[model samples]
Target: MNSVLIIDDDRSVRSLLRSILQKKGFKTRECADGTSGLEETVGYRPDIVLLDLLLPDMHGLEVLDKLQKAPVTRAIPVIVLTGSTDQENRLSALRSGAVDYIEKPFVAEEVTLRVTTQLRIHDLIKSLQTAVQGLEDDLKAAGTIQRALVPSEVPAGIEDEIRWIYLPSSSVGGDIFDIIPLNDHSYLVYVLDVSGHGVNAALISVMVHRFIEDFRSSRPGDREPFSLKEFMRSLDRNFQFERFETYMTATCVIADLQKGEIEVSNAGNPFPLLLERKYTQRLDRDNNGAIGFGMVKGSTSVHKISEETRLFLFTDGIVDVRTCEGTRLGEKTIADLAESTRHMELDDAFSKYQALLGESLPGAQTSFEDDVTFVAIQF
Candidate 1:
């Protein structure tokens, strides 16, 4: 039979509870004060404790605090029995780690039902913890594999200096950006963000990177410069065959500094920002396209690449971050900040923007409900 400890100052209440629990086939122990209850809890090691809020010697909450602190009594499920049904009292009881809260006048059947349910949930939680530990081990292995797939160092032939910042909200992130040098003077700069977070998203990102590498390698003949429109079409076709529900938002900017030309195409991503002469402009005006890699079946709207001195491609995580006042840090803010810091180095501009965000939204917490990635190139 399960043992239960009932603690209350009222004699009548304690008697009623002891009788009811005894009749229900539970071994019952009763105490009249909080101090005695705390001592008895440690010595008796009862399976469950029915604790009251009001007591003569010490407050019931204090008894609960002691039980929580004692490792032996901490796992003994506690159900707070209180006369008050105020929201604050209920929240306090719950926050103090009571398994459940029961009002003083709770029905006998309801109390028994709640206790049984809590025991069952406790068992379930233990099982789930074991399962999760196994899953965590698997995830660690997956993270290793994913990290290995990403290029350790920028390819040697890429003429442009590339600097990247990648942060995964989870063990792995879905955001991926790479600078693949096609030749000595020009390179393929692409930034992609998968729709979701975690292992699935990271796996999809790796697959996308492999596909991009394969596509570039398979192309025959002299490296002819293709328009941004052609690149987007190829991506759409590739996604059509994969048939995966996961969609990828990407911005691919092919920069040829020797020719002083940049071809950019974006599919449902934040517009790439450009800076020059203390001015910032959004390179792609038409943000009206669907994400590629199975988000949509057909070709999406494309924006013709325009010339710019410095180009930046980023994920929505940066712009959609909320300020301390709950306002979104939108594209306008980013553009303005970029323009203001145009004279600074590309790396300096990024650092300044980060500081500006932190300063502007003081006390705002990080992890803005999404992953953020920024890729900048100066030509």
Candidate 2:
């Protein structure tokens, strides 16, 4: 049974309330002053507290404030009992943390109804809080798994030549990228973005990442060589919109160290930016729609890479970031930022770019509206 503590200075009033509450199948406790009432509240942890505004030791509003401030007894519903007809005191009681109020000469039926209603409300709030906490725990677990899909370290021999950054809008996000060493002379680097953000988008991204990892691990020595175009086709065929009801944008860069060339294949993603010694260039000009559409064709092209050549692959999150003025920075602004940072070290350049992006946001906000993935590779 739910419990109530009646804190009133009048002996007859306390007895009357206790008698009525016990008859209504409630557990009851009584105190003659605010001090003893607070002590009883802590000890008993009652479901509800009936507090009289006129107490001998401390003002009833002071007791209510203490109850609301305490972590242990804060959630217990408080109903203020007042003999004074002052509207200000009633409002003050509510503002001070009383959930409801009982006027002087309280009716037994009104007291029971108010107590039961507040108890039901309290129970509902507790249930909702429990459900929300469970969801947060699940999302945290999913975020850990999603983070594992991204590369924590660059492949050997090219660790210092690559730099990247990723930020999700929430605990789990739709962006993922990795650098896998294909053989002694080449590496496969790619960045992918699912259609949306949060858990659903993150689930699809994990599926795609696992699919690519499986393909990399299961390739046979005697089969056709690793082709970017064929890989795109395989991804498109497996994750069609008819099956998943979603789509993804991706850009894959195959860097051949021995051949001094890099093959770029893109599908409905931002064009890869290539930084040379003298000028910056945009690779993969053709716009093939996003993957999972069942009709996405791969557009693969080759570009020469010198020691000074730096190739950048990023999702639209970077370019689509809105400035304080609510205008998207756009591809040209991103290109200009990349060109301006070309003189710095790779890591420093990434830091500078991130700072610039942070400055573009309105006011003190730091996070973007979408998941972001940025990768830079120097041959």
The estimated TM-scores of all candidates read 0.63, 0.94
Off by over 4 Å in 2: 220-224, 361-366
| CA lDDT for candidate 2 | 0.87
Candidate of highest TM-score? 2
In the range 48-75, model 2's lDDT, one tens digit per residue, is 9999988999999999999999999999
Candidate with best lDDT: 2
Could you tell me how far off, in angstroms, the CA of residue 184 lies in candidate 1 after the best superposition? 3.8
After best superposition, candidate 1 residue 223: deviation in angstroms? 7.1
lDDT of 1 by residue, 50-142 (tens): 998888998888899999998988888899987755667667888999999887776888777877778778778868988999999888787
> Alpha-carbon error at 90 in model 2, in Å?
1.0
